[model samples]
Target: MKPRDLFVLVGIIGIVLMMVVPIPTVMLDVLLVINISLALMILLVAMNTTDALQFSIFPSMLLITTLFRLALNVSTTRNILSKGEAGHVVETFGSFVAGDNLVVGFVVFLILVIVQFIVITKGSERVAEVAARFTLDAMPGKQMSIDADLNAGMINEQQARERRKKIENEADFYGAMDGASKFVKGDAIAGIVILIINLIGGLIIGMLFLNKSAAESAALFSKLTIGDGLVSQIPALLISTAAGLIVTRATSEGNLASDITGQILAYPKLLYVVAATVFVLGTFTPIGPTATYPLAIVLVISARRMQTNLSRKQAEEEQMEEEQQIEEVRSPESVISLLQIDPIEFEFGYGLIPLADTQQGGDLLDRIILIRRQCALELGIVVPVIRIRDNIQLKPNEYVIKIKGNTVAGGELLLNHYLAMSPGFDDDSVTGIETTEPAFGLPALWIDEATKERAELASYTVVDPPSVVATHLTEIIKKHSYELLGRQETKALVDNVRESYPALVDELIPSILSIGDIQKVLAKLLREKISVRDMVTILETLADYGTYTKDPDILTEYVRQALSRQITLQYSDRGDSLKVITVGPSLEKKIAEAVQQTEQGSYLALDPSSSQIIYHRLNEQVSKAIQTGQQPVILTSPTIRMYLRQLLERTMQDIPVLSYSELEPSVEIQSMGVVNL
Candidate 1:
C-alpha cells in the first residue's frame, strides 16, 4: 500500500485501540495535544473554504474525529479514576487555565459544552437537515436546467454529464452532513456524562479506597474531573464551530474572511457614519479624548484607506478591460473569426428581444431548447446549437430563422397580441389584423389579449409571440433537418447504436457501407420526415440489403419498407382507415417506363408534356384529398415511388409519398382519389 493509505489504516486501528488499551501519561498528553491540533486545523479549513463541496469529505472527517475524541475521553477517564492523574495537558488546564480553582474550571467547561451543544451543534444540525431536504427536492429542477443548457448548445454532452454528476455529489454531501451532525450532538452529551461519572467515581475512590479526608478527596477529584472535561470539551467546541461554519457558508469567490472584508467593509460610508456616531457619543457622555479620540481617528483613517483601495481596484479593472478590447480588435485572429458561421442562427429585432431574454420573462431560449430536444426525439437527429441574437437592421418585431447563414423563414409578431387561427369556419366577430401563419401560411389574425377568450370560444388556436416564432422555427428545422445530419453526426449515431447492437453496426458500417453511405441513407429517411430513432431496426435492414447494393436511394427504400409499420402508425389515427391518393395504373406504368437507370443513379426521362400532365393530375387529386379533410398521401409502386416523389417534391413538399411496399399488411387503405395522365 502507499504511505498515505498505510498511515490512514494504522491511524484508524490506533483510534480503536485507544479506548481499550491503557496509555502512559506521556503518550496520553501527546494524543490530547494532537486531538486539539486536529480540531483547530479543521476549524481553520472550514472557515477558509469558499464552497461546501470544496470540503466534501468534512462529514467523514467529523465522524472520525468524534470517535477519536470519545476514545481519548475513555482513556483519560481510566487514568484519572485509577492513578489519580490523567496527563500533563489535563493537569495544566486544571491548574493554570482554570487558575487552580475547581469551581471556576467546572463553570468554564460547562459553558463551553453549552455553547457547542446548544448553539453551534444544534444550528448546524438544523441547517444540514434543511440543506439536505432542499438539495434533494431541487435535484430534478437542476437536472432539467442542465438538459436545457445542453439542448440550447450552451454546453456539450461532456459538460452536461459533469454538471449532473456535480449535482448528485452535492446532494450526497448534504445528506451525509445531515447524519454526521448527529455525531457531534452525541459527542456533546457523552462529554457531560463522562464528566459527571469521573467526578462522582473519583470522589468515592479518593475517600474510601485511598483513605483520604472528604475535603482533600473533593478537591483532588474535582480538579481532575474538571480538567479532563475542559480538555475534551474545548476540542469538541472547536469541531462544533467548524461544523456550523461549513453548513452556513454560502458560495463565494473567496473565503469567509475575504468575503466579509470585501462585502461588509466595501462601503466606507458606513464606517464614516459609525465614526461620526462614536464621536457624538464621546462628546455627549462625558467620555475623554484619551480613548474615543484615538479610536475615532483610527476609524476615519481606515475608511479613507478602504475608499482609496476600492477606487484603485475599480480603475484598474476598467483599464484592463479596455486594453483587452483594444487588443482583441487589433488582433488578426479576431477578424478571421468572423468567417465562421453557426449551424443555426436565430436573429430578432429590438422589440422582440423580450421574447428571448430570460430577465424580461422571455422563454424563447428555453422554448428553442425544448424544440431541439423534441426534434432529437421525434426526428432522431441532434439539432445544432441555435445562436440567438439581436439584429438592429431588421424592423422591430421581426425575427428570422437561418440555417448555415441563409434565411429559411422570417416573421413579424405583434408583441401585445395573440395569433389566432380559426379551426375551420371564419370568425369575423373577433376583429383583428389579418396575417398569414409563418409556419404553414394559413390565414391567421393578430388579436388583442382581451379577445383571447373570445377566440378560444370560437374554437380558434391561439398562441403568444414566442410560441409563434417557436412553431415557425420547429417547422423550418423539420423541413431542413436532413441538411444538418452530416457524416460526423451519422458516426455519432452509429457509435451510440454500437453500444446496443454492436455486431449489427460492425457488419453494416465500413464493411458493407461506409459512414457517408449511412449518412445519405439516414438523410434520405429524414428528408421524408421519417424518424430513424429505431436505429437497431434501420441498421438491421441495412445489414440485410447493403451487400447487394451500395446505392443510398435504393438502400433507403429497403429501410423504409422495413419501417413501414412505424410510418403507417405515424400517419394513421388509431383504429382509423388510411386514406390516400393513388396514381392510376396507366400513369404508374408510363412513369415506370420513363425511369432510365445510369451508373450514377436512376432519373425520370418522361417528356415535358407527359410530366406536366402527371403534375396537373396529381395536384388535382391532392386538392380533392385536402377538401375531404384527409392528409395528402401519394401511393405508387415500389419501383416508381422515388421518381414520383422527386417529381412532386417542389409542388407538393408537404405531401408524403409512400410506396406500396411501405404500408403494413394489416392496415386498411381507402383510396380517396386517383391521378391519371
Candidate 2:
C-alpha cells in the first residue's frame, strides 16, 4: 500500500484503541485540538462546495469523526475519574467556562447538547431523507431526457454517458447522506449520555480513592465533566452544521458565501427601506437617536455605494458585449464558418413552417428520424443529419432538397390538401388542383378533405401533405446516398463490422484492398440501388477476388454475382419469373470487340455512329418492355455486362442492367424483346 493509505489504516486502528489505551495528558490534549480542527475544516469544506456530489465522501467521513469523538470521550473520562485531571486542554476549558461556579458550566453544556441533537442534527436528517427520496424519483425522468437529447443529436455518445454517470453519482450521494445523518444524531445522544456517566463516576472515585470531601468531589468533578462535554459538543455541533449544509446544498455557479451575497443582496434598494425604518424608530422612541442615527446614516451611505456600483457594472457589461460583437464580425473564423455546408439540407418557404413546427401539430421532425432509420436499414449507410431551415428566397408553399450544397429536387405543397395520384385511371369528380407527384413523376391532383373520401372511393391513391414531403425526402436521400459515403463513413462501417468479424476485416483491409478501394466498390453498389447490409458476405467476396483486380467496377461485378439470390429476389415478380430485355449476340460481340484496355482499366471505346445506333435499338426495346408493363432490365453476358452498363449509365441511370451471372438458377428469365445493332 502507499504511505497515505497505510497512514489512514493506522489512524483508524488507533481511534479504536484510544478507548482501551491509557493516553498521557499531553498526547490527549494534542488529539483534542486535532479533533476540533478537523471539525472546523469539514465545515469550511462543506460551505465551499458548489454541489453536494463534490462532497460525496462526507457520509463516510461523518461516521469516522463520530467514532473518533466517542473514543476521545472514553479516554478523557478515564483520566478525570482516576487521575483527577484529563489534560491541559480540558483544564483550560474548565477554568475558562466555569470560573468559580459549576452550575453555569453544567447548564451551558446541556444547552449545547440539546441544540445540536434537536435542531441541527434533526433538521439535517429530515432534509437528507427528502432529498434522497426526490432524487430517486427524478432519476427515470433524467435518464429519459438524456436519451432524448442523444436521439436528437444534441449530444454525442461520450457526452451522453458522462451525463448519465453524473446522475447516478448524485443519487448515490444523497442516499448515503440520508443514512449518514443518523450518525450525527446518535453522536449527539452519546455525548449527553457520556457526560452523565463521567459526572456520577467521577464523584464516587474522587471521594473513595482520592480522600476528597463530598463537596470538594462534586465541585472538581463537575468542572471536569462540563469541560469535557464542552470540548466534545463544540466540535459535534460544527460537524452537524456541516452535515446540514451538505444535504441542503443545491447546484450553483458559486460557493455558499458568493451565493448568499449575490442573491440576498441582489437588490440594494432594500437597504434604503431598512435605513428609513431605523431612522423612524430613532425619531419616535426616546431611547434611540444618539445610537440609531449613526447606524442609519452608515446604512444609507453603503446603499448609495452599492447602487452606484450596480449601475456601473451593468454599463460595463453592455459595453463589453458590444465590443465582443464587433470583434467577432472582424474575425476570419466567422467567414470560414459560413463556408462549411451540411451534407443534406431541407429548405422550405415560410408558408410551409407548420410542417416542421411541433407546436403546430407538425410531425416532420419525427418523420425525418424514421426516414433516417429506414435509409440505414435499406441502404446499410448512416444518413447524415438533415438541416431543416426556412429560406425566404423560395416561393411560399415550395420546398427544396439539396445534397452537399446543390439543389437536386424540389416541389410545392398545399398544406390543407391531400395529393391524389391516379391508379391507371382518372376520376373527374375527385379533382381539386392539377399537380405532378414529386417522388415518381406520376400525374396527381391536390384534393381537399371534402374530396379525399371520393378520391379513395374512386380507386385513386391518397396521401396527406406531410406524407408527400416525407416520400420525396426519403427518395432523394436514397438517390444521393452514394455521395454521402466518404472515407470517414466507410471507416465507421468497417469498425462496426470489425467487432464481430475481426479476423475477416483484419485480413481484407490495407492488404488486399485499402478503404478507398472498398469505398469505390460500395459506392458503385449503392448507385445501382443495392443494399450492403450483408457486410460479412461482401467482405468475404472482396477478400477472395481483391488480389486479382483493384478496379472497383470489376470488384463490384464480382460482388453482384456473389449476391445473385438477393438481386434475383429484388427484381423478380410473381411466379419467380424475371421479365427483361435481352442483349443479342451481335451487339454483345461488337461491345466486347470495342473494349479498350490500358494500365488504368478497361473502357468502352465504340465509335459515335455505332453508339447512336445501339442507343436507338436499346431505347426501342426498353420502350417495348415498358409498354408491356415490365421493368426495363437488360440481361447481358457476364463478360460485357459492366461495359454495357457504362454505355447506358448517363441516359438510363434508373434502369437495372443485369448480367446472366447475377441471376439465380431457380429464377426463370422471360425475354420481352432483344436489343441488336
Worst 10-residue lDDT window, candidate 2: 566-575
Off by over 4 Å in 1: 1-310
lDDT of 2 by residue, 1-677 (tens): 99999999999999999999999999999999999999999999999999988888999999999999999999999999889999989988988998898888988888999999999999999999999999999999999999999998999999999999999999999999999999999999899899889889988998999999989999898888888999999999999999999988889999999999889888889999999999998999986799889989999998899899999999999999999989988998779878899999999999999999999999999999999999999999999999999999999999999999999999999999999999887777886899999998988999899999999999999999999999999999988889999998998899899999999999999999999989999999999999888888899999999999989999999999998888998899843999999999999999999999999999999999999999999999988888877788989999999999999889889899999899988888999988887
Model 2, residue pairs in steric clash: none
Task: For each candidate in the order shown, give its overall lDDT on alpha carbons.
Answer: 0.90, 0.93
Best-matching candidate per lDDT: 2
Q: lDDT per residue, candidate 1, 1-677, as tens digits?
A: 89999999999999999899999999999999999999999999999999999999999999999999999999999998899999889888888757757778888888889999999999999999999999999999999999999988999999999999999999999999999999999999999999889988998999888898888888887888888888888899999999999988888999999998988998998888888888887887888666687788889999999999989999999999999989998998889879998889999899998997789899988898899999999998889999999999999989898999999889999999999998999877887999999999999999998999999999999999888998899999999999899998988899999998788887887889899998999998999899989989998998899899999989999999999888989887762568888888899999889999999988889898988888888888888878888888888889899989888778787799998798888888888888876
RMSD of every prediction: 10.1, 8.5
Local distance difference test, candidate 1? 0.90
Q: For each candidate, what TM-score against the reference?
A: 0.58, 0.68
Q: How many clashing residue pairs are found in candidate 2?
A: 0
